[model samples]
Target chain A: MTLAPFEGADALVRRNNISSQGPEGAPAIVFGHGYGSSRQMWRLVAPQFVDDHRVVLFDHVGSGGSDRRAYDRGKYDSLHGYADDLLEICHALGLSEIVYVGHSVGAMIGCLAAIAEPTLFDSLVLVGGSARYINDEGYVGGFEADDVDALLDSLDANYLAWASTMAPVFMGNSDRPELTAELLDSFSKADQAVARQFARVTFLSDLRSDLSSVSTPTLVVQSTNDIVAPVVAGEFLRDSIPGSRLEVLEAEGHYVHVSDPEKLTTTIRSFLG
Target chain B: MNPGVQARDLFDLIPCGLISATTRGVITTVNDTFLAMVEKKREEVVGHHLIEHLTPGSRLYFETGFMPQLKAHGRASEVAFDLCLSSGETLSVFLNAVVDRERDGGTILFAVFDATLRRHYERELLAARRLAERSETRVTILQTATTAFGNAGSEEEVAHALADASRAATDAMAASVYLCDPSGGFSAPSSSGAAKQLVEAALLDALGGRGDPSPTGGLAQSPTTVVYSGSAELSAHFPSAAAALRTARVEALATVPLIDDGALGGILLASFGRPRRLDPPTVDLLESLAQQSVLVLQRIRLRELISYRSLHDPLTGLPNRHSLQRRLDQLLTGTHPNQPTIAVLFIDLDGFKSVNDRFGHLAGDSVLRRIGASLERAVRSGDMVGRLGGDEFLLICEDADEQSAGDLAERLRATVRNTPLEEATGLSVSASVGVSIYRPGTSPEKPTGDALIQLADEAMYQSKRTGKDRATIIRA
Candidate 1:
């Protein structure tokens, strides 16, 4: 059956490049992507929810198909700015009782939005999330201040490579050239300046104080051997947020949604029920 | 040439390091050049994550930035990283990699170039470019500040313009100008941005004299600009100020003293919210701003002094007769609803001629100066008191009628009587006071300032004829 992505899209939907599908008048499930990735990262997992819920996916500003001009450095200096954009998108679409599934930085964006408006979200699924990336006195955040600075340097060093990576990779599979092209196109559209600043904001931001205020039911999904967000970070998220549970996936790597989509989808489905 | 044999030889003998690794970055194979560059054995290199051989920063970049791009696009090129060698040194390397994909994962081939010379050159170029940009910003700030100061009519406006210009030049979170008072201490600062608390805390630290050594150090030894970058650096110099900054989440401070011609004109303070090591160029910009502001402030003060001398009595420092006439004309020209009547009180000292003859002209000048000060104190805030040459003084008041003006005239007569001639023993002074009242929209004819003064002089003669130490009132 044919699934119309933007059947009844509005201004916000067009601006954020939102793609929606599912039965009408169904409970909505929105997916937010993390740093270094966009809405395309949700490709393997989001479709599983379409049978029962209205699945919505959109790119954050300066990433994917979202309008790059909307990226204001002052406004997006903190994650709250991204939360404001998310709330605006949700309000424009008239979506409430939302099941928000966010990964990495997007997870904190969801948490912030949920804290600002508790009644709008029914639940939150945080994958590979950390409140703070830098290790404090007692916290094991898996990184240091110097590491974050190095990450910014890395961004500068890779600017040329990232800009030129738009060329499509057609090794052996020539039949599915369009799919590969679309993926690369969205990945290449991410503004380099925005990505650099976003990295700084994401790594330097400390949301430990804001976590205890979250009232929505949450599911912290973590992966084994995840370098960015370790198991301790997942446990911290679960303990800090009220009524939240932690689930450790048997997968390896930070991107659990991409590494093991079936397991991630099953866990999300179980949690929603 | 045999193709397979030539390719094998070329791979081992290549100048750059080459490696094959798993998608997860675990090295599976490495050429001879790669082993020689890292100064490691083949076994030590293989079966370890490629990130282990890289510096912390490059490792982070590879995983978080480069790896993701490589995974999505199947290739990445010209990515720079620093590889840690076994000899306790780093190799600045640029990599070009391609992934051979499988159903679930992939193997990757990486070509690494030693870019030590290139990286060094690039850093030099970047620093030069940044210096050029900062120089341009400094010039623009000075130009804008010069224009603003040239147009500034008052000291407060100059202070504001300097504050704004300094903040823009330094990219500070907040900037302020603390003017020097006559007592040689700084006055309350005129600020250009928010975070007044941060400025206040920093100002206290600056004025506390921790930075200045040898209390009597004159202009030559005075510190030009004192910059503290982080909490530790700030705490080392000013502990309490650092504590205050910690509470405000401020991390950097630069204090530039505005000095001109061996006198402390004022001070400029710039603060930052993030930990920042302000380079030498930024410090230079602060000093330049401070110098420009000092020159502008000097100009403003000089102009103010000249204007003050022109319209004021040199002996008593009271407004001269010319200034009084101009003020009276201005008051009479305006028309408004419920306008108050303007009253002019003219007074002539009764016994001043005898005191001048007895105690010399210096004593007479001292008595005039004392009376000028007393009259200035006696008048209302909006009233103007002026000396109209030799034993004559004028007082202008708004919102006064005939009865109130007569009362004020009597008070002035008493003030003159109570004047103690210190140099001449047993000598005292009194005044014959006259008042003229003018009501707007009520009088038959409007009188000019000279005519009004003449009428008051006639009334003063009437007071003198009747009795000394008395007042007379007349409506003009």
Candidate 2:
């Protein structure tokens, strides 16, 4: 489900390449993409509901086809800035009771936006999302703080090669080389500074407090063998989000819709229906 | 697969690197072009975990963004990453992958394309944009400073304006303008900016004995722009100023000396928290600001001196006849609501003609000057005493009552009698002072300054008729 993204104030509109397609009279579903990728990641799922539900897609200001000149370091320093953009987008479109589908960092961004503007959304779908990435007491984020520092160091030393090395890890089904090739192509075109900043905002952010306030009908899409958002993390999201449902997909990695689209779509339909 | 689609994947003719790996990211296939791209044989790239060939950042990206997408989708496409060539040059590439579960545990296919040239162009564009932005900021600062300089009025005002302009022109912590007075004294008006505590200390440098005129002074030596970057360098050159700024957390300083002809007019000081390099245009902007301020300061000083000469006597530096009349006019008519009474004592010296005739005019002039000073000391603080041209002096007292006026008249008489006129060899002279009081309620005529002077003059002649060294009051 998607509704046309909002466009008011030329600077904000141009900074974020917000666009949409679907039946105007239908309920709206706004799609938020994760870091390192843009609205292009929703190509398969977004088109499926366009005939009945309004489908909205957009590239966050530092990614995809967004105007690079408008990227301000002061404004993008925290995750709240990203959430503010989401609220403004929905506000501009004059949409209420929106269906927000978020993946990875985008999922947390949606949760924060909903908390800030409760009337804007009625439901939330969190796909492979985690509140904190650093391993803490009684929490398994899978990476140590030193590991993150090393990652930043490597990014600084050779950014271009870093992208290539990351593709194999992200696209774990490396047997099918085309899957990773496409993902890499999507990453190569992004501005290096924007990419690095998005990385910092995503991993360094902690929004566990934001989850308890999300009273909307929420669904946490958990993958069986997902390495990014582990089973425990998905369970944590389901537990933290009051009255939220958890549906486990028999997918191999963190990305469920791309691996088993039928199962993910069927589960969402059942929950919403 | 169709022959045409299958032929497209032919190793040597593909014109790109191609590889395949299982779900665990263990490499299974490596094409000739891929081997050629890394300058490695098939044995080198094949049968290696994808993690082994990736850099730490790339590995992080894979675990975070890439691996998740592929694991869920079963196929991922158009992802970008870097590859280190054997020749030690970095090459950017794009990859496309699809999972195949038949032969391996979700075997993935890979297609890569070189994107080094594209990346170069994008980098060049981003750099150009940033340079343009910095230049725009410089233009805006200069424009603001030029306008402020055009409107400044006094040396103090100009110094104040320059302080504001200097801080705006450069991103400095604080800025101050120090100026030299004609008497070899230096003073800096309070300046405020990012660092207030240090600026107070910088002003103290101008206040100390360094204000003394010496051609080889610190500010005098800095006729051109000077910069001290870092704490060590700043402390070595400007020890006191450096200490203040350092305490305020400032690490750098730049000074532009203001010199008008051969004299040092002032110095402009700005403190910074980082090492500063003033480019040619920026230096020119500061130097021009200094030049404009000196011109304005000189003009203001000349105008002030001229304004002073207009209302004061050249020889004795006392207010002239015109100034006294104007002051008297203000006191008489300016009080609107309250008709508070005022008194004017007009004194005309007795026996002064014989001294000028015998001892000459030079001794006469000296006696007049000394008497003028004595009369000044004898009057109340609020009274105005003026030399209204040769031997005739006028004193105006405001807010006075009848009893107070009478007391002041007697004091004037006694003081005049006590003067032992000097240097004429035993020549002791006294004066007859006529007091005229303008009590608006009891006055017979409209109170005017000229009328009051005339009445006081007439009363002084009456004192002379009754013998000198006495005061007579004329009721007006």
What TM-score does each model's chain B reach against the true chain B?
A: 0.84, 0.70
Report clash pairs, candidate 1. Answer: none
Per-residue error for B304 in candidate 2, Å, reads 1.8
Top lDDT: which candidate number?
A: 1
Worst 10 residues of 2 chain A by lDDT: A1-10
Candidate 1 reaches a DockQ of 0.23
TM-score, per-candidate, Cα-based: 0.70, 0.51
State the TM-score for model 1. Answer: 0.70
User: What lDDT tens digits, residue by residue, belong to model 2 across residues B235-332?
Assistant: 67666665465445455677777878866777777766444556777778788778877887888888889888888766557777788889889987
Error at B44, model 1, angstroms = 5.4
